[model samples]
Target chain A: MRIFGLRKNTMQEELKHNGLYSRSRQALLLLACFLLITFLASFCLGRYGVPLDELIKIILSKLFPIEQSWTSQMETVVFNIRLPRILMACLVGCCLSVAGVSYQGVFQNPMAAPDILGASSGAAFGAALAILNSASNRMITVSAFIFSLITVCIVYFIGQRAPGHRVVNLILAGIMVSSLFSAGTSYIKLVADPTNQLPEITYWLMGSLSGTRMSSIGFVIIPMLLGLIPLFLLRWQLNVLTLGDDEARTMGINTNLLRFVIIICSTLITAASVSVSGMIGWVGLVIPHLCRKIVGGNYKYLMPATIIVGATFLLIVDNFSRNLMATEIPIGILTAFIGAPFFIYLITRKEKML
Target chain B: MSLTTQNLSFSYGIHPVLSGLNFSVEPGQLVSVLGPNGVGKSTLFRCMLGLLSGYSGRIMLNGLEISSFSVRELAHRIAYIPQSHGQSFNYTVFDMVLMGTTHQFTPFASPKKRQIDAAQMALEQLGIESLSKKSFCCISGGEQQLVLIARALAQQASIFLMDEPTANLDYGNQSRVLDCVKQLSQNGYTILLSTHNPQHALFYSDTILALHGGTIAAFGVPDDVMDESLIRLLYGMEVEFMDAGKTRLIVPAQGRGDLCFVGSHR
Candidate 1:
């Protein structure tokens, strides 16, 4: 009987090993190479007709001191517009996806997204209120930052104090607070000065990379990168946290402290993303799950894959929004247009719910 | 070598789960906790491992208060295998077991070579070394239980607190797990485990504790707590204790005479 059991276990083990090897490592390598290629392609393909050779030459010139008569238009297209937009997309995408991944692990729910817990709504309300009160642009960002922090604090209190402290209750509280704040935002929009601030508010809510300037890039990049620093440093603790709160505590981790730090970090990441990009949707939610399906769930693997995939995904979404039609669709609309269908495909194609 | 409790009590909201529960164990002794389902067996283990808070209790391990030790220090002293875990989403078996060595690692440090070897040894001890690469959720329930127990063993703690380690196993696996528990005890690890199976308690434990209504009902030798009246009180049913040569068994009083006669004839 023991011999039979051993033989059966070995056969089962071999089959599982084959499946894991075939699916995980190759998918990871392919996704990594695909992200790199997409980033380079996004850099090269644009309205200014920079051929791949000139693009590579321009890139090499920038890196090394190669002499070439690069036109002012080419320089402006490459360095000023395309580079900043791509960099912003990469930063915001990476930030949002990392936040999404952390939140999913912390909450242990696959449906969790970056904005699901009122972070984006809270930031939007802050930005809108800033517009209402004639606050400076920088101060508008600060308002968004502070209010997003407040939203999470309120949600945490409500969820933690509920009867069972259930994950569903937390999610419900997030939706409740989110809708409430969004309604408040609508009210602000209703009463704003239509001639001056209305277009600003409308465009801000629509989310765009059209206004991608180097200064604006620095504004969001600095804080978002700072917010991501802690996550990178404590990445392993994040993995341990996925084992659930009780198990994490039993493993000699102070689960509450780690969770509090994570909430602050991811909130900062999310708030910074919204403060700059004005609420790009679905990249955070979809990118991490896509990466997880491809690379398995170890955060050591999941984190880097998420960064690269998020960058590539947003770049692609931006490309579609830019050239797919005569009029530029807002990046948010394109994200939703592409994201919902792709997410549906993922859900349908998935054999098991993670 | 000794763990002693002084007037330990725990409550949730207003209702107490364990009140004034006192017990002690020395090195190399296997202790069994027998109680009905909701009699605070799991809670008691949680408290002993310092997982639950808001409890007024004094649990001392080797002359030190349990609460005084850091979580890592406490984990080094007492390892636990919980009865149930919420399903993991495709975490590799090796990663699941490697988590046990988190206490040994320097917070963010990855598992060292020695720790990996230790985890491998623990899996081998449970006869599941081949499961190291399998997704944890894809394995059978019994195999999962073995992996968890193997993880607890990898902790290398001096004391083991197991909450129903054999609760979900089939008879063959149950016997194997119990034999492992016995072997651990013989190697001078003090073990206190809660179980629903009286036979496991009888066959493996050197000390038996029976709890009822948040208090200790019977405590001492297997011969003392394994009596019909105490077992009936603990389980709230009539049970007949019978001895056949060196083996002991408990059966319901009224219906199972045929099986008993067959065993007697055998």
Candidate 2:
């Protein structure tokens, strides 16, 4: 019996040794290359159209005092405008994707996303309110960030107090809170001046990167890093969390504490992303699924892969948003358009690996 | 390691599940907990693993109170095998088994090379190394149960608490799992498993603990505790024992007037 088992084992061992790591490595390399290409394309394919060689020269000149061969307007577009927007796109993408992955694991639900905790609706309400009051751009961003955090906290507290399964309760609580804030947003929109505030409210709710500035980068960077770093460090624990609360507890994890930490971290990154990017959807919901298709479900590989793939995916989508139409389409619209169909395809596929 | 529970009792608001239960298992013993449905066998196992609290009892592991042990310490000493169920994510068999080594890993660190080797060794011990690369959700039910056992083995704990380990298996698979449990016991690993089948207790376990009406109805060696009277009382069915060569077979008893012959007259 042992001999027969061992004979079969040799075949499996051969496949295991050859199949897993090599495939994962190849996927990682491919994603990295795609990210690089997308980043360069986003920089060069914009309206002003900086050439690839000049783009490289400008980036190099920043570190060292190279000859200023490019025009100063080109310099402003590269450093002051396009560079920050590109970087912010990458950051927001990474943030939402990581948060989505974490939420899915914690809830053990495939449909879970970062906005499940009412963050987007709450942030939209805050942005709408600020727009109604004629607040400054910075004030609007801050209000949105603060309100999103508040909404998540309320959902979490209500969920904890509710009976039945924790995941179900949290989801139900989220729906309630989300609807409340969404109503609040609608009320604000109804009261605002239709000629002035209506279009601005509509634009922010639709989501875009037009308002991304170098000044706002500092505000988002600190919180995004603060949230992302802890999540990356705690990736292994998140794997255990996916096993359900009772199983994780048996394995010596403090499930409640780990869950609390994960929620806070994921919330911080999500709120930061929404404040800057204004309710962009689909990247959070779809990118992790796409990454799982590439790297499999082990969070050790899945988390980093989600980060890279998400950044690349959003940058490509943002490019299309700006360049596809004469007027800039909202980033959120493009993501939903791309994300919804791909998600349908994933579900309809027979393999159903997830 | 020895496990002893003294006066363990638990209730859910107005309804009591386990009441004043006292039991102990010696090292290297295979003990079967026999009970009807909803007799709190799983709850008792949970209490043993410190997964459930608010039970008034002293649970001692090798003479130390279980309450004194931290979650990590308890995890190192006792491993739990929950009933196998489908997962939302389809983790590979190796990844599933690697989770047993979580207690050994420091916070913020992934499983190292040594841990992976241990997980591999566990699969090999269970003769399941060939299934290491397969997706867990796609595997057969028996294979899934074995993977769960392999995961417990990877924890390297001396005591194992399993809840209905073979509840969903066919007869052949059930025997295979019982054989594994028997082998583990011979290798000096203490095990306590809950089951509805008294025959499994008769054939495999050294000690049978029969629970009824929120307490232990019988506790002794299988021969002492598993008589026709106890079987009838526990399951509400009359039974008779027949000798077949050297082994005893249990069969349900029929009423005297119900017998009839339909074959041709001889």
Candidate 3:
């Protein structure tokens, strides 16, 4: 009976529906604390290696009048180099993961990820196109962001015009459009010089947070917020929206409009994150699933938990990517290497993944 | 307020699903829709719930047209109970029921104490409060149906539109769900339930609206409109009305000549 889902939750009724939920509240608090700790530790990492005490004092100097004892090199490493990259890593992870959860909710498909609507693929095409033309990194990011938005818009329009279940149509249209952009990227890569342009295009496609500057964050922050803020605000409607179209409509949701908003917001996050970080895999797909294990599957907890865990997951992965060897490993490769085995381990365990 | 549909007709291109249907369901009446497969019972419920907007007719909730009301206003007035099915994620029973009260709050806001209390009260009313913390997908089909009913109850709507509420349920669960629905009508809640069984309609419903080929076959109290001929017209089968004390049962007619033993089997 226990194995077959007949297990009765025996926690006292007075525990505020206590079994999974109260435990998740505690888990969320613990994860937040852990994220804070990791954030501090990341500031001290890298070849420059600022000591923990110096790191704390330097952080405190911003608030109170603490004497700056640390050298200018440490300051540069913390503020100029590590700070931007670390924040970029965390933000990109957070955005993509949240966008993944939103897409899954919107499409009601568990396999849905940040690129379900072709945002990342479209960004890739833009990045590849930029690299072929020998454009600057800033131009590549701009091109990627613009094309990503355009790709999702095209998918949405085609999805609406196509006949069938809207969710199925949208998903199929996403596949069609994503393949189209992916082919474009392939063509661009083929035409580029094998010496310089090819390597650059290939590396960008592999996804990295290397050379992340404050300006990179500056370019993407607005669209990311435009996406993340609305998703965070519309968290509750998520539960109803996942019930499919007619069910959601009868539940008093304007299913078309809600789907549109979720798609747009999630697309913004995906495009923004991919423009800077390239097509980072698994952070968006796996983080939400992991968060669902930690917290229950309710969107209220799952969404926020994904945000924290995503930031933490990518930050740690970036740490390993940068520090694991002399040459920086591509973060995308590290994610699949680390994420897939861990996910296999998770699924092999007793509890259900969904 | 009563729900009335006037010449409500809908089609998929030239393929008509429901056409020129007119019926009225009064307050606190348990109206069971009985039909054969593809008789547009589902389509009728869809039109009534204001889901199929392409339909050309007026569906009035009280005095106002259903189309004139906002989605929130319609939800406040009528709760829809879809058949229990699997979802991509496993939300808790409490979370499932809490979804019904979402119309009372904004999308940006989480469920507050008022919404929680309503959801709890609904579960309590259905006597399934103990299942609150359990995974919805883990529960039995019966319990899932009950949870959906509890969800509809939490919506605080006077009218309920259920689409094949017992489609995949076992006989025991089907009766249990129908009994609960019967109790709701007795407690002064209006309910529109669609089912395949004429016996369930006769025993549990106050009125029966039978549909055939996208049109009304019969619409009235079961006592006045239900019989063997009507069943024959609807299902194209010979059935007899067998008396079972107070409630009559629809049984297949005995002694079919084709089914007679003509072969060598002793």
Sort order, TM-score high to low: 3, 2, 1
Error of 2 at A70 (Å): 1.8
Clashing pairs in 1: none
Report the lDDT tens digits of candidate 3 across residue range B120-189: 7789899999899899999999999999999999899999999889889999999999999999999999
Highest DockQ scorer: 3
Give the per-residue lDDT digits (tens) of candidate 2, residues A235-334. Answer: 9888888999888888878888999999999999999999989979988889989888888888988898999999988888888887898999999999
- Among all windows of 10 consecutive residues in model 1 chain B, the one with the lowest summed lDDT is B256-265
Docking quality category of candidate 2 according to DockQ thresholds: medium
Q: What lDDT, from 0 to 1, does candidate 1 have?
A: 0.81
Model 2 lDDT at residue A317: 83
Model 1, chain B only, scores a TM-score of 0.91
Give the CA lDDT, 0 to 100, for residue A124 in model 2.
95
Model 1 TM-score? Answer: 0.90
DockQ of each: 0.26, 0.49, 0.51
Misplaced by over 4 Å in model 1 are A1-30, A133-140, A160-169, A193-199, A346-350, B84-88, B255-266
**Candidate 2: pairs in clash:** none
